[model samples]
Target: MAERSFHVARLPGFATMAVAVFVALYLPIFTLVAYSFNASNSMAVWGGFSLDWYAKAWANEQVKDATVRSLVIACFAAVISTAVATMAALGTTRRRAFKGQTFIYVMINQPLMVPEIVTAVALMILFGLVKTVTGIHGLGYLVLAHAAFCVPFAYLPIRARLEGMDLTLETAAADLYATPWATFRRVTLPLLAPGMVAGAMLAFVISLDDVVITEFVKSGGQDTLPTYMLGQLRRQLTPEINAVSTMLLAVTVVLLTTFFLLTRKKD
Candidate 1:
């Protein structure tokens, strides 16, 4: 007979814990989402239901500028991070394990292990030196910084997909005397494309939502949406900020949904 089912006995406890956890996590989000529709500027008490704050957020020039800048930075960061991650994943997975393989993997994922504030401070100091030497300014640094930070987020899924792939097709391709480029082009690349796309989307979202690194590295007048929202918060609390957050939340949900759909197809 199977082992005695202690799990069943703990089921009610687990259920209660799960409910408590979900409420703790999502109640604040649900509250914010609800207040986004509130007509009054106050978040605590709902005056009524209205879309005025969203309209105001849409019409704000600062919001528009920050949104566009964020999109541009996210696009560049995602493309760069995804490409770098894909190459790293291939290097790590498509060959036999070598000496220092674990070290290399750890190095690639360092940003994730390192504290964000530590990373941010380090980048800030490094970029300060780079700026002194290069005299370059504006979005370039932000994009590069974002890409560096987002690389691990992109790398994880791509590496996982590559690792999960059956070697049979790849081995057959090799046996067919196909050149490396042609074999990858014909077989590995096609299979890996969805993972790459998923990684890119994840990287894009990470870049878009980043605020700490952005705050540390961004030059004057380079405020991203998150930074802008922070600035607004510092000055005054407004329901407009909630509306902006809701819009960002909407964008994030859409990207995550698309990522899930793509990964589901892969599965």
Candidate 2:
């Protein structure tokens, strides 16, 4: 008798289960997007399709301010987090195994493991003390909080890229009397670009979508798009909110797709 290989796909009802899971996960999202174009102001009613909500969202000055603020915070956070993450990745991966390596990893990813609410509360308290001492308040707190939160996200991809890199090129450069910095600049950096880009995009998306930390850390009048949307939700329901959500969803989808393409190995 021939030995049989097991496959999860071959398990009973696996395909059905997978389909059900995807539908459960995405059905609400699909519904939201579909209703974004509804002509009616009511969220629950299905009206004829129209672009009125999109136009309204575009004309809303509050939306514009929130959108710009969100973008600025996300851009700054992505740059700061990605740079720190790249350095961390190099430090952790380029050296031989050392004592407390696991500890370092856990520390780096502590935000990911800890509840977001916990992190938010901690940041709120810390920022509150700083504000009391300095009597200064600004968007800087949100940027810093987001950067810190996004570090683990950026680090993982860069570390994965570094681990998968070929050391042969660096060895060859060294044999040719190239300095470590020179080799890294000329060789390692180029190869690491994709991972860094992917990491940055992921960080950008996380920062852009962040609500808990932003809500906790922001001063008055510093609402980002997500927080603004939340505030609107508290006040009323409208297709304009749905339209804004759909636009954000589209942007997130694009960035994530690009990240996937950049990080995927060409086989």
The candidate scoring highest on TM-score is: 2
TM-score of each: 0.95, 0.97
- For model 2, how does the per-residue alpha-carbon lDDT over 1-267 read when each residue is reduced to its tens digit? 234777788899999999999999999999999999999999999989999999999999999999999999999999999999999999999989999999999999998999999999999999999999999888899999999999999999999999999889899999999899999998999999999999999999999999999999999999999999999999999999999999999999999999999999989
Candidate 2 lowest-lDDT run of ten: 1-10
Q: How well does model 1 score by local distance difference test?
A: 0.92
Quote the RMSD, in angstroms, for model 2. Answer: 1.4
